[model samples]
Target: MGPSVMKKGLLLIALVVGGGCALFLYAAATRGLSAREAPSAAEAYATRTFRRWAVPANARLLRNPVPPNPETLRHGMEHWADHCATCHANDGSGKTTIGTNLYPKAPDMREKETQSLTDGELYYIIRNGVRMTGMPAWGNPEDGENDHETWTLVLFIRHLPQLGEEEKHLMSTLNPKTPSEIEEERQEEEFLSGKDLSKHKSTNGRKQ
Candidate 1:
């Protein structure tokens, strides 16, 4: 192609991109940048497009080195419960309080929107994380190409569609508990064991 033709093509691309940016800025200004509101369909499309573009071409083709087996799934379930369950939920429903409140909100991983993604795409997202979203990079860059845990997570994500009640129950057992929750459990255990309960009762020194 001649220089003039190439220059014209570049100019057109630039104009399109600039126009898109202007429209985005106008929307932001008018709508007010609030995380409480869900993103519009246009915004969602743009975000997905950007995420696709951000992943490296080679990364898209990369395969999980970890073997998918019962053991691998168990380990992935444990890791997910301890770490990801806070936002993603044990069922991959993303229905937790924190997940629902996130801007663009955490996705329901059981749905086609997440399940349709390739294993490599899931692994890449887990390792690197998407910018302007709640996801954080969980894998260390120094881990090189042998990030077994992240690969295991990829397998677990694929298994979300087939998640069982028993699996979810196990994950709930593995999930992290807050101090209050732990304390409540301790008290319940004590009560269940027929331990003294006077300390927990109101101590106003008045007869009921």
Candidate 2:
């Protein structure tokens, strides 16, 4: 075929593919992509493909500088509990109400799909959140201080499969407490310290 004819053929093919994709998206939008519903196979594939390509080659190859020690693990656990537990859960299972409701859904880190990623890849995702996903960028790239925290998280992600119940219990304490929880802790401490319990009496004369 002549150069002009070949160009025309390729252009026609592109137009056809683009039109089909537009129609599919339109149909999906009308059908309702509910947050509570699991992502369709095509949606999952496209999201994964985009994420795979989004990370730079250098970022994927970069290694974690922080050593995987008990201290680092503890810090990572505390960080996860305070900041990530709401969505990811203490065990990285992503089974929490918020995690399950996200459009694409938070992935369970212990699963092969997540564990298969390299340390650097995981770090990149943590430092720079994936687009169109609930995961947020936890680290400021310009802040050197944030790098260690994210690297530690990468180690923690690796440790998810081996996470212990004792560690999870410890994390619960580190997790952020509500005002009611803080007040309850204060009252418990006072009671243990032999403070007057009469002040805590309810209308029925029972200690609340």
lDDT of 1 by residue, 1-208 (tens): 9999999999999999999999999998999788878889999999998898888888888888888899998889899999999999999999999999899899999999898888888988988887889999997899866799988888899899899999999899999999879978977997999977675555535333
Candidate 1: misplaced stretches above 4 Å?
1-30, 197-208
Reference-based lDDT, each prediction: 0.88, 0.87
Worst 10 residues of 1 by lDDT: 199-208
Query: Would you list the clashing residue pairs of candidate 2?
Result: none
| Candidate 2 local lDDT, 1-208, one digit each (tens) | 8999999999999999999999989988987667888988997888887888888887788888999999999888888999998999999999998999998888888999999888888988888887778989887779643488888899898999999989888988888899889978987998999987666655347444
The parts of candidate 2 lying over 4 Å away from their true place are 1-30, 144-146, 197-208
When summed lDDT is taken over every stretch of 10 residues in candidate 2, the lowest stretch is: 199-208
Compute the lDDT of residue 105 as modeled in candidate 1.
92
